[model samples]
Target: MTSTDTSDTSVLDDPVGESLRGRHAPLGRTLGRAAAYAQDVATFSAVPADPTAADWSDLARLLGPGAFADMFSCPALPPAGWEPVFVLEGRQMVWPDGGRPDPEPAATGPDVTELGKADVPEMLDLVALTRPGPFRPRTRELGTYLGVREGGRLVAMAGERLRPAGWTEISAVCVVPELRGRGHAGRLIGALVTRVLARGERPFLHVAEANTKAIALYERLGFASRKEVTFRGYTTP
Candidate 1:
């Protein structure tokens, strides 16, 4: 298993290569090449440095003709044949001790509930309203998602994203604009963390570097920043 944080090599030297290679290997679209990613290109894209032209070819063939992203753990110059759709920078945080954190003495609001496949429509609508991240129809298959509903409307949610080997990513954590400070996000995160720990896995997540509010929240909740990663978007010629 690759460490959540690495300093043994330059990020450009390995980038997200190890984690992609080790944890999400089964979800990979290509083999025998340094680049790998989840089966869902719409969800995420990543490339290790120094991918051969053939590696790109295999990924392109899997992706077919369209626009998608290629998120590198470290920022580097774009490859020759691909068009740069956009570039993003963010921080990856992790809770290494299997998501265990000091228990909060406060009570979880009654509106909070565990969500399943039956909740996809409401989940997508909330995702559309909040734009937390790329949440597709099947993204929920990654793991459990918890939410807080108000008047039968899903208002806040937090759920798993990437599942490498021993860790599960807590992602798409969002709350409606009107419900910002009532601890809805915290409630959902706590619920998810509990679930991750119960299953013998740790929790991790990503957030834009500029999103200090969320960063502070995660920090307060005992998550530590692991690395600064660049999310690169790519498109075919």
Candidate 2:
């Protein structure tokens, strides 16, 4: 991976917050310093960097009683009444400077197609089988999604999420278990990377630390680790 100045990484420190407040503002609900995506859009919620008591209260009110809040990579812990739901160790990886993917096969293959609302059912089915991450019915509304099909059945897919300032997150890159190691993921990600860079934004993604195979693929695709992160979720109190 090629080295580049990372002085502007502060925006990434609160990606969920930045996104909810910026490009995704219309798709989210904000209450004071607390904010979250609309129901069915995504489960991610956010608070100020140094959250106050009121911030937690606002988030709780926003999510209502006993709602699940996916605090993606937020460093602050919530109040005692908020129950921990899940936590995953992950890393933020960014496309390195001067890095570019070879032309994506999607450029020529009829199998690679842009997905839409009509594809959500199959997309959800794939997510259920792959456990890529949190993907709800409306999640695709967040950004562009692309999928690879085989004999008219969706098999592999990837898409954009969390547009934080000048960056776009490449997420939900998953392939069928039966089709593993076939370079489908790499192609999907490469296509998305090309699209992101073309629009004057950088590409980044999060991957579970235990998924070493994915980390290797990301590295091979010109992504370099920026920082370790803890993905946390909690129940609103």
TM-score for each of the candidates:
0.81, 0.94
Q: Among all windows of ten consecutive residues in candidate 2, which has the lowest summed lDDT?
A: 1-10
User: Which TM-score value belongs to model 2?
Assistant: 0.94
lDDT per residue for candidate 2 within 85-196, as digits (tens), equals: 9999999999875466775343344366899998999999999999999999999998999999988889999999998887889999999999877778888888899988
User: How many residue-pair clashes does candidate 2 contain?
Assistant: 0
Worst 10 residues of 1 by lDDT: 6-15
Best by TM-score: 2
Pairs of residues at least 3 apart in sequence or in different chains that clash in candidate 2: none
Q: List the residue pairs that clash in candidate 1.
A: 45-71
Misplaced by over 4 Å in model 2 are: 1-7, 103-110
Model 2 whole-model lDDT (C-alpha atoms): 0.89
The most accurate candidate by lDDT is 2
Candidate 1 wrongly placed segments (more than 4 Å): 1-42, 48-50, 72-78, 96-99, 103-107
For model 1, what is the error of residue 142's alpha carbon versus the real structure, in angstroms, after optimal superposition?
1.2
